[model samples]
Target: MNPRITDHPAVPYERTRRVAFTFEGRTLHGYEGEPVATALHAAGVRVLSRSFKYHRPRGIGLTCGAPSCPNCQLTIDGQYGVPGCATPLRGGESVRRERAWPSADHDLFGVIDRFSPFIRAGFQFRLFRRSPRLAHLAERVMGLIAGGGREVTPDAIARAARPGLGERRTALAVVGAGVAGLAGALAAADAGLEVVLVDQGAEPGGALRAETAPVRTPDGGAAPGFALAAELAARAAAHPAIEVLTGSTALGWYEGGVLPVHTPSGVLTLRPARLLVATGDYDQPLLFPGNDRPGVMVAGAVQRLVNIDHVRPGSRAVVVTRDAYGYAVAAQLCAVGVEIAALVDPRPGERAGADAEASFPSGVAASGVPHLTGHRLREALGRRTVTGVVVEPQEGVDGRGRAVRLDCDVVVVSAGRRPAEELLLQRLYHGDITLDPGPGTALPDGVAVAGGAAGITDPAEALTTGADAGARLARWSPENPALPEISPYPLSPGQAGRPSSSGGTSE
Candidate 1:
C-alpha cells in the first residue's frame, strides 16, 4: 500500500475494471485500461527489466510510456518485444522480463556487469581474431547470449497486425496532440479547415493530462489544470472537423507529402495540404554518476506515476533541479504522503554556503521540504536501485565544500527538457529544406511548426502559436473558405485552464 496511491489528493483513482495478469509467473491484479508498468509499480515492483551490456536493473527511464525506451520492453503473451508501460493491461496476459535467463531479478547474464570493462570497447574485434570464421562464430555465440529477447513467433506477428487504415486526405494534419497540437486542431477546425489530430497517447493533452496544479484561463481566472485539460479535450473530441486520433503517431514523411501514421487499429497515410508539427519536448536526464539506477526517474515520470496512474513513486525522494519544475514535482509527491528528502538546486545567484533560500515560488512552496541552494547531485548510491544520493556544493566555495548524502529510495530529476526533434531533423536531412532555430522561422512550403516542437513552452503562447499556424494554413489552402482568424482565450498569471509558460529552445 505504500507504493499504491489510492487516496491521492491531486489525482483520483478511477480504474475502468478489475483484471488479473501474470508477471514473472506471479498473478497480479490491475485495471483493464491501465499500463502494465503502472500496476507493477503500484505493487512495489521497481526493477522491471535489465540493461543489455551490464545487465544493470532498470525500472522506467523518464517513464514517458513511450515505446522508444527500453525500460518497458518485455515478453508479453508469448510474444517478444512489447511495451509494458504503454500497452494496456488485458486480463490473463503473461509478461516476463526479456534478455535475462532465470529472471530479471536473478539473471545469469548479470556476470557480464562485472567483466564489462574488459569487453566493452571493440573487444570482440580485438580478442576473437583467430580466424574469420572462428571470429564470426564467436560473434554469433555472443549475440545469442547477450543480444535480446526470444524470437518473435510468426503466428503472433500474423495475428497481432491488421491491415492499414489506407490514405487519408485532410486540409491540415497536426502531429502530437499535446497542448499545442490540440489547440491547433481546434483553431483550424473553427477556421473551417478539415483537421486530423494525431497523438501517441491513449488520450489527448500530453503533460497537461498529468498536471495537478491550477492554471490561468483565457478569462484571467484560475482553475485546476487537469480540469482545464479535460474541458479542452472534450471540446476537441466533439468538434466536427477535428478527427482526434488518439493512440496513434505520425511516423515520418513519405514522398508526395504523405505522412504515415501508426495507430492501435492500423496505419494511416495522411495527406494534408498543410502540416503543423507540435511534438512536445521530453524531460532531460540529469548529469550524475548513478543517474541510470532503477529508482532514479525524471520529475515528469514521477508526475505521470502519481497524477495519471495514481501510483506513489517512492516513500522518500530527492529532487535534483535548477528550476521551479523540481519544486512542483515535490508538491505533487507531498500530496500523496511522499516525504521530500531534499531539494538540491545549483542555480546561479544562490550562495554556496547559504542555508536555505529566502523564499520560493508558490507553486513549489513546501514548508517542511529542505531547500538546499548551490548544491548539485554528485552520485546516486546503491547497487541495484537508488538508496541515497550524494550532493556537493557548487563552485566558488571557501575550500570547505563537503559532499552530503541523503537517504532516499527515489531521485526525481528536473533538469529541463529537450525538444522532440526527430521528425524535424529527419526532414532537414533528407528533404531540401532550411530551418532556423528561432522564435519564428520559415519552414518548407507546406510544413509549419508550433508549440514545444517550435520551441514554445508557455501554454497560452503555444495555443496562440497553434492558432496562428492554423489560421495561416486555412488562409493558404484554396479548398477551405477564408474564415475569420482563430484566437485562443487571453490569459493572466495564475489563471486556471491554461498552462504557465516554461522551458523551450528557440526553433
Candidate 2:
C-alpha cells in the first residue's frame, strides 16, 4: 500500500520536485530533500536490510533526526555502511541493501534465523578448533560473508582520502540546533559573544521540526512547535554574531577543546572558548517478541515520517505507550487518516486515575478510539512486517485480566527516551569532569550541557538552562531576561515529566 499522505494538518505534503533513484537496480521516484528511507517507505518498501547475525528483516526503527539503531543501513553510491534514514534523496543515486544475499526481500540467508538457537555467540571460535588451517579458512569465509560484498569503487576511495580538515574559532560553540541550542546561541550572541551553532538535521529546530502540537508560550498563548522553530532559525540565520551550520555533525571532542565537525562539503575543526551540548534524546524501543520487525517503529520516528516527510507509516496502527506521548502519536496518526486500532497503556491503574491521560489530545478521545489501560504489550505478531499485536494486563500490577489481540500494520512504540550523552561521556574520560545526577554534571571549565542531554526534558527548562549556560560562559549574569518563564505544562505530551535529582523521572 502507498503510505504517502498528501493532506496533513500540521505538515503540507506537495510532491512537486520529484526525483528518481535506483534501489537494488530498480528505479524508484521520491521527492527531493526527503530522507531516502522515507521515500522507500512511501513506495511501500518496508524491509530495508537484514540483521547482521540472524539475517532477520529490518527497517527504519528511528528516522534521520536521531539514528540510534543500525536497522536502516545500506550501501549508497559504492560507499558501505551508509545510514539510509540520514541520507537525503538528491536524485540519481544508487542505493543497495547490505548483509543479504540475492535480495533483502527474498534472502537466502534468512534461513539462518530459524537456526539461530544453534549458532550462539562466539560459535565461530569453537568450530574446527583442532585444525588451524580449517579455522583460518572458516575465518576468511565468515569475513567475506559479513562484508556484504562492499565494492571498493573510485567514489569510496575518494571519500576515504582526507586532506587537512578546515578550521574555525568561535567564542561559543553549540551542538544541536534544537530549541536548547538555538536559545544558547542567541543568548551568547546577544551577550556580544561570537557563536557557532551546529546541527546534523537538514534544518534547524531539532525535534520541533517534527512536532505538530501547539506549545505553551510564556505569554499564556499557544503556537505550533514548527512555527517557533522557523522563527528561531530565521533569527539565527540573520544574526551577525551567530553562524548557523545545518546538515553538519559533530564528530568528537578532543584535546584542547578541539571539536571536529563533519559538514556536507568537508570536515571542519572548531576551537571555541566555551562549548554547549544540547544534543537532546533518542526514542527508546520497547522490548517484546518480534519487536525488531519492519513495521514496528519508534514514536518519534513515526512523527518525523508523518509530520516532516508527510509519509504515512502504515494504514492502521497499534500504539503501545506508558505515557501521554503515545496518545499524541495516535492523535497525529488519526489526523492523517490512519485508523487507530487501539491505544495501549502499560501503566497499572484505571484510565481516569492516570495523570498522563490528562495530556492526551481531546480530538483523539472524542474520536471513539479504544483506550486500553493497565495493559502491556506481550508480543508483536508477524513474519516480516507487523500484522497484529498481543497484549495482556501486567501480571502483578493489574491483577487477573484477559489478553487482547489487536490487528494493525504498524505498531507505534512510545516507551521512553534516553539522553544523547556521547559527547559528555567522552569529556568525562578524556578531561577533568565529574558526573552528577540529573543536569548537574560537574563539567570542566568552558564546557556545559543543556536540554535533554542535561536531563532537562521540559522545553521551557531546556531553554532556561541553555540561556543560563550561555550567559554564564560569557561572564554575564546567568539570569537572562530575554528567555520566557518556565510553564507548568509545556503543552507537549511526554515532555511534562519532571526530572528527579537521581536523574530519574519524578512523574
Q: What is the TM-score of each candidate against the true structure?
A: 0.89, 0.89
Q: How would you encode candidate 1's per-residue C-alpha lDDT over 116-177 as one tens digit per residue?
A: 77876667777766677877877777766754434777877886886888988888998887
Clashes of each: 11, 0
Best by lDDT: 2
Over 344-426, each residue of candidate 2 has an lDDT whose tens digit, in order, gives 87676564224334544354457677777777899999887889999988766763568989999999998767677777677
Which residue segments of model 1 deviate by more than 4 Å? 63-67, 348-366, 397-401, 435-442, 478-507
Please list the residue runs of candidate 2 whose C-alpha ends up more than 4 Å from where it truly belongs after superposition. Answer: 13-16, 62-68, 128-136, 159-163, 351-365, 436-440, 476-507
RMSD of each: 5.1, 5.1
Q: lDDT per prediction?
A: 0.72, 0.75
